[model samples]
Target: MAMLPVYILAGICLSYIILLLSLLYGWRNLKNNPRFVSPFETGFSIIIPFRNEQLHLPGLFDSLKNLKYPKNKFEILLINDSSEDDSEKLVQEFRKMHADLSIELLQNQRESISAKKDAIKVGIDKSRFEYIVTTDADCKVPENWLQGFDNYIESQDSDLIAAPVIFVEVHPEDPLFRKFDLIDFMSLQATTIGSFGLRKPFICNAANLCFKKKAFQVVGGYKQSGNYAGGDDVFLLQKFKEHKRKIDFVRSNNMIVTTSAQKDLRSFIQQRLRWAAKSAGYDDSFARFAALTVFLMNAALIIGLVLCLFDASYLQWLMIAFLIKFNLDFMLIYKAAVFFDRKASMRSYALSSIAYPLFSSGISLTSLFVGFKWKGRGYRK
Candidate 1:
C-alpha cells in the first residue's frame, strides 16, 4: 500500500511528460509551417455578440473603423443579447458615424438557454457574406484581421479557421491578479495551438473563430448545443470536426485578437467556472481526456501536499512532483508567451504555479455542483 502513492506520482509524471512532448511537437510543427497571405477576395460577415458591454464597445468600434479590409467586402452584424445598458445606443451612435460601412444592429432571438448561441445564430441568418466570423464585443482585432483571414481562406479550402486571442496588458503597473490571469490564459492558448498540432483539435475561442455559412447550416447552427450558456465556440468547432471538415488554426500575428482580463478575483473565478462548466458536455474524447488529465495532475499535486503533513518523508516526493510539473508547464507556456509577445508575464509564473493547483482543483470541483454568474446572468449546470 505504501507504494501506491509512489505509483500514482509516477503515472502523473509520465502523463505530464507526454503532454509536454505533445505541446512541444505542436509548437514546432506550427513554427515550421508558415501561412502566407494572398489577395483578399472572400467576403466576411463579422458577428459581434454583446450584453452590457458599454465600457468596451468603444475599443471594438475603434478597431472596426481601423480595419484595413475593403469596406464593401465585409459587413458587421452587432447582435444585442438583451443588455440593460446603453450598448444599443452606443452601437447606433457608432453606426451613424460610419455610414459607409455595412453595419447592422439586431436583437437576439432567444430560442434556448444560451442567449449567446442564439445571438450568433441570428447574426448568421442575417449575414449576407459567404464566411461568418465571430468575435466578442470586449475584444479588439488587428487592423489586418479580416485581410489575414481572407488571405487564408482564399489560399486554402478550409471550412473553419481558429485564430489566436490574448489578454491586453492594461498597464506596466498591473496587479498580481491580472498577471495570474495572463499566465493562465496563455497556458490555455498554448494548449489550443498544441492540440491542433497533435491533429486532435479540441479547443478554440469564439472571440476569434471563423467558419463557413454553409458549414454552420449543415451542423444545424447550435440547435442542440444551445442548452449550455458557454461553449458557443468550442461546441461549434466540435461539430465541424465531427463532420471531418477542414479546420485550420490561423497562427499569424496579424490575426490575433486581444481582450481585457477579468479585473477582480471573484469575476475571474466566475469566468473560469463558466468555462469549466462546459467540460461535462464535451463530445470530443480527446478534449475530455486532456481536461481530465490536467485536472487530475493538479489534484495530485494538492493531494501530495496534504500527504506531506502526515509524514515529513513525503516532502521529498512532493518536491519532485512540483518540479516536474513546473518545468514542463513553463516550457509549453514559454513557447506560447514568445509567440504572443508577452514573455514579461513569466515574472509571476513561480508564484502563480504554487497557487494554480489549488485554484484549478477548486474550480473543477465547484463547477460540478454550484452555478456561476456571467454577463449579469446566473446559470446552473
Candidate 2:
C-alpha cells in the first residue's frame, strides 16, 4: 500500500514517455521533398479573420505583396469581425495601392458563437477558388507559402493540408519570456507533425491551413462547432476526419508562416485559456487521450513534488519520473527546433521545463471553470 503512489507515478510517466516516443517516430517519418512542378495551377482563396489587429496588418500586407505565386491564381479575403480599430481602413488602402492583386475586404456575418469560424465560412462562400487557405492577420507568410501548397496539392490528392507556424526568430538577447513562448510553440508544432506522421492528426493551426472548399462544404463546415468561441481549425479537422477526407501536413520549412508571440504574460495566459476552452468540444478519441495524458503527466509531476516534501521516499520516484519526461520532451522539441530553424530557442529549455508543469497544469484547470477573453470578447466553458 505504501508503494501505491510509486506505481501510479511510474504508470503516468510511462504513458507520457510512450506518447512522446510514438510522436518522435512520426515526426521523423514525415517528409516533404518539394517536387519541381511547372507553371503553378492550383487557385487559392486566402482567408484572414481580424479584430483590432491594425498593428499587425502591415506585416501581413508586406508578406502578401512578396508572394511568389501568380496573383491571378489567388485572391486575398480579409474578414473583419467588428474591428473597432483602423484594421478595415488599412485593408482598403492596401487594396487600392495594389489593384493588380486580388484583395477583398468584407465584414464578418456573425451567424455563430465562434466569430473566427463564421468569418472563415463567409470568406469561403465568397471565394472564387477551389482551395481555401486560412491564416491570422498577425501572421507573415513566406514568399513560397502559396507555392508550397500549390506544389503539394499538385502532388497529392489531399483534401486538407496543415503547414507550420513559428514565431519570428528569437535572439538570445531577447527576453526569456519570448524564448519560453517560442519553445512552447515549437513543442506544439512538433506534436502536430508527429501526429501527422502517425496518420492520425488531431491538431492544426488555422494560421497555416489549406483545404478544399468543397470538402469543407461536404463536412458541413463549422456549424456543429459553432457554440464554441474558438477551434475554427480543430473542429473542422475533426469533421473532415469523420468523413474520411484525405488530410496531410506540409513538411517543408520554406513554407512556414511566422507570427509574433504574445507581448505580455497576461495576454499569453489568455491565449492559452482560449485554446484550452475548445478542448471540451474535441470528439477525437486520440485528441482526448493525448490531452488527458499530457495534463495528467504535468499534474502528477506537481503532485509528486509535493508528496516528496511530506515523505522522503517519494523523492526517488519523482526524480525518475521527471528525468523520463525531461529527456523525452527535449528530444521531441529538439527535432522540431531543427525543422523550424529556431534551435537557438532551445537554450531556455531547462528553465522552461521546470516551469511548464505549473503553467500547463494551471491553464488546463483554469480553462475548465474560468472564462477567458480573446480578440476583445469574453468566453466561458
TM-score per model over all chains: 0.97, 0.98
Q: What are the per-residue Cα lDDT tens digits for candidate 2 across 83-103?
A: 999999999999999999999
Whole-model lDDT per candidate: 0.89, 0.91
TM-score of 2: 0.98
lDDT of 2 at 248: 90
The residue-by-residue lDDT of candidate 1 on 1-381, one tens digit each, is 276897898898788788778877987777532554567789999999999999999999999999988899999999999999999999999999999999999999988988899899899999999999999999999998888788778877789999999998645688788898999999999999998888889999999999999988997778768778999989988899988899998887878899989978889999999999998889898887788788988999889888888877878888998998899999999988888899889988999999999999999999999999999999987
Backbone clash numbers for all candidates listed: 0, 0
Q: Judge candidate 2 against the unseen true structure and give its global Cα lDDT, from 0 to 1.
A: 0.91
lDDT, residue 144, candidate 1: 88
